[model samples]
Target: MQIVTRLIAMTRARKLQRQFQLIERSIVALPVRTRSRLAIMTLREVGQASKCEFPHLYGTAPEQRYMPWGQGTEIGFSRAQSDNAEVALRGIALWLAVAYHETKESPYTSLQPQHRQLLRVLRELRDAGAERDAMAQWMRSGAAA
Candidate 1:
């Protein structure tokens, strides 16, 4: 039945949320500097996969959440086209935000237009699929589209 199929898909989506939360909790427990590095690395990876420049996370409301200033890396974003990049980009963005609370390096960071889109994505990381209301919130983030 259509109802049954919808329920199954919903179940999987919620499960994915929970799994991501578990990942976030584990990642946040690491040292702050390590978390920061990982966050930057995640940003670069997300941008690379999305076919955009790396996101500037420092100027946003959330700001970069640590210490010792992360050294800058100048890597060009280029790749032979691939259809699967979008999938990787989304997951990378979500994971970065999960650790974003630990970000804390600056002096050359400012939000790009795509970064605003990223902020919307970050907003969905909350609630961790703990309730129906939270699940609805995730649905609104357009992550499933």
Candidate 2:
């Protein structure tokens, strides 16, 4: 049964990888200016959602795609926080990287690089913690604790 489940997951992963390739190709064909504007718009949208639940567009990497607006807003908020904002900014950067390739804008007009870097760091920390938590839960559940 476990083997069957693993095989199914592998199939899904392959499908997702193909989809990612297509998304990459589309992004590469976009105009630079449009890309920039898209980033700005995406960030603006993210900022607007700062107070909501699941503010950073959280998702498991293998099964989830980040939303541009949500990522940008998270970065903006991290910037606003003024300290240890890397995680939020990183989320924004990742989304921007994907979005910029598909739009016309320059991809940092609204949010500066320093802030973006901070956001990136914060995201790493957040992801690490989540991973640790997940592993711990799995271990405990399996009587391996």
lDDT of 2 at 54: 37
TM-score of every model versus the real structure:
0.34, 0.30
- Which residue pairs collide, candidate 1? 65-103
Q: Write the per-residue lDDT of candidate 2 for residues 1-145, one digit (tens) a residue.
A: 8677556545533433443344334334435443343345445544543433434442213233444332332333333334343343344434433332222232333223333443453354345545666676888895784
Candidate 2 CA-lDDT value: 0.40
lDDT of 2 at 71: 38
Give the Cα lDDT of each candidate: 0.37, 0.40
- Candidate 2: 10-residue stretch with minimal lDDT: 97-106
Cα deviation at 106, candidate 1, in Å, is: 32
TM-score of 1: 0.34
* lDDT (Cα, 0-100) at 144 in candidate 1: 63
On the 0 to 100 scale, the lDDT of residue 8 in model 2 is 55
